[model samples]
Target: MATVVPPDLELFLTGWLRSNITDVDGLQVGHRTPDGYDGSYPLIVVRDDGGAQSADRVVFDRSVGVNVCGWTRNSPKDCRDLAARVYGLLTGEPDILVGFAEGSSVCAVVPDGCNGPYPVTEDAPYCRYYMTVEYSAAGIRQS
Candidate 1:
């Protein structure tokens, strides 16, 4: 029987977020904002600040930051509402991503979901909210 190779934590995470968050219609989600992303209101960009490896190297902990930014031409409330949705989606369940790979998904003990809407940058163009989730990836092979 061919053994099913397990996916790395980082890879699994990227895929998980893409599948979970980007599925929302009209929301542009990616690891990086799309080129010429200007005018693209309701954009979500995800970044992973890779975590420290466990002593056994079978686990890791990292912070996944999602920035929900948009052109709030008329209403900042729209942006706030979108940010709330984003927060709820991310904080729903850390276990949702645990089965991504066959016996390879990260088993999260505690997912510290979401951090900031850190001072919205209204720089004449777009309004942005920065939020971060801290999650631990257990049973993930470093290799």
Candidate 2:
């Protein structure tokens, strides 16, 4: 019997956005935002919101959260704009073949919903915009 390893959506998304989204050149994409990240103006963080697997464990349905952060003391327009670009890329295509790895691949990515460009009072000079996406991935088979 082969053991199955679920796909790492965070790594896949971070890399996918970095490679595909050309709108924001030099954008920093990662799994989490540092405690006091003050180095970059615009950055993106990906989170696994969790999901379930099929009875046979061959298919996985995942919920992922994508947060776009912009450092602007005055307004959240920067974050909103960046978020729009990210949303466009993710929602533009009906079926995106995320990639193939370890005999597994992300079969589909569907845009679930999007939230606002809200002010991050705790972060003070930063604003954030978020979106939720659903990813259907094929389980990896490791013998």
Candidate 3:
């Protein structure tokens, strides 16, 4: 069966990331992932990676990943700090409204995997961190 992208994953994740992930000033969240920062420290970019459907094709699950980056000159730990926090907040988060589902509240957000606070460049004065987050919702698709 063909997999269908969850309709509300992006919409729900944008607000979720802004409110829960980017909790500090000078931190910014956007849809596009930048190769370098635009004066925004602790930057988070959310993107729709991929998704899947249940074996019976009734439920949809999607993966939305984020790239968190921070400057690494004076305070060299910000990127990892933000990455750890984002991971903590996302794992096992329940009851998020995935609007495509029929149940009143039927969704869970969890960490799929994680990658560095590794240097963005050998000497670019920045650190890069990435995490793949999975959003799963089981419901009857709206006709």
Candidate 4:
């Protein structure tokens, strides 16, 4: 029997991206992968969201869209790289918010039985996503 080598999807894609995007600057990543869930694609939102934060706000300038689909998977490196990019776009700020995202329109891709209308909340829980950056640094109201 021929030995089947497990392919490292993240590593492969990371290498390929690094080799191609030469002009880009610093990058970081944040991931929120769901366990035992299969049906919808993972949400990957990459962008520059770093700036002056307060006791209640966070501002962002630019956000990149990393919509993975058609059998595309994510990795830890992907999360870090995404955060780095967001930082670079905002002048390399370490205080970055790297996590999942979901707007008022889009619903998270979940299982069949556990699927339904998206909840009515501001901080939408995203499973296996990098980010949802803004173009300019803004503030958040943690009130």
Q: How many clashes (backbone N, Cα, C below 3 Å) per candidate?
A: 0, 0, 0, 29
Ranking by lDDT: 2, 1, 3, 4
lDDT tens digits, residue span 1-143, model 4: 33222222233223333443455334222232335334143233222222323333333222323321112233334434443443343222344212211111111211222211121122333223222323332232332
lDDT of 1 by residue, 27-73 (tens): 76667777666645677777777666667665666677777778654
Best by TM-score: 2
Indicate which candidate wins on lDDT.
2
lDDT of each: 0.61, 0.71, 0.60, 0.29
Give the Å error, residue 138, model 3. 3.7
lDDT of 2: 0.71
TM-score for all predictions? Answer: 0.69, 0.79, 0.67, 0.23
Over 24-126, each residue of candidate 2 has an lDDT whose tens digit, in order, gives: 6557889998888863557889997868887888888877788888667467777777887777665444354454433335677655533433434554566
Using TM-score as the measure, what is the rank order of every candidate, best first? 2, 1, 3, 4
Query: What lDDT would candidate 3 get against the real structure?
Result: 0.60
User: Could you tell which candidate, 3 or 4, scores higher by TM-score?
Assistant: 3
| lDDT accuracy of residue 138 in candidate 1 | 62
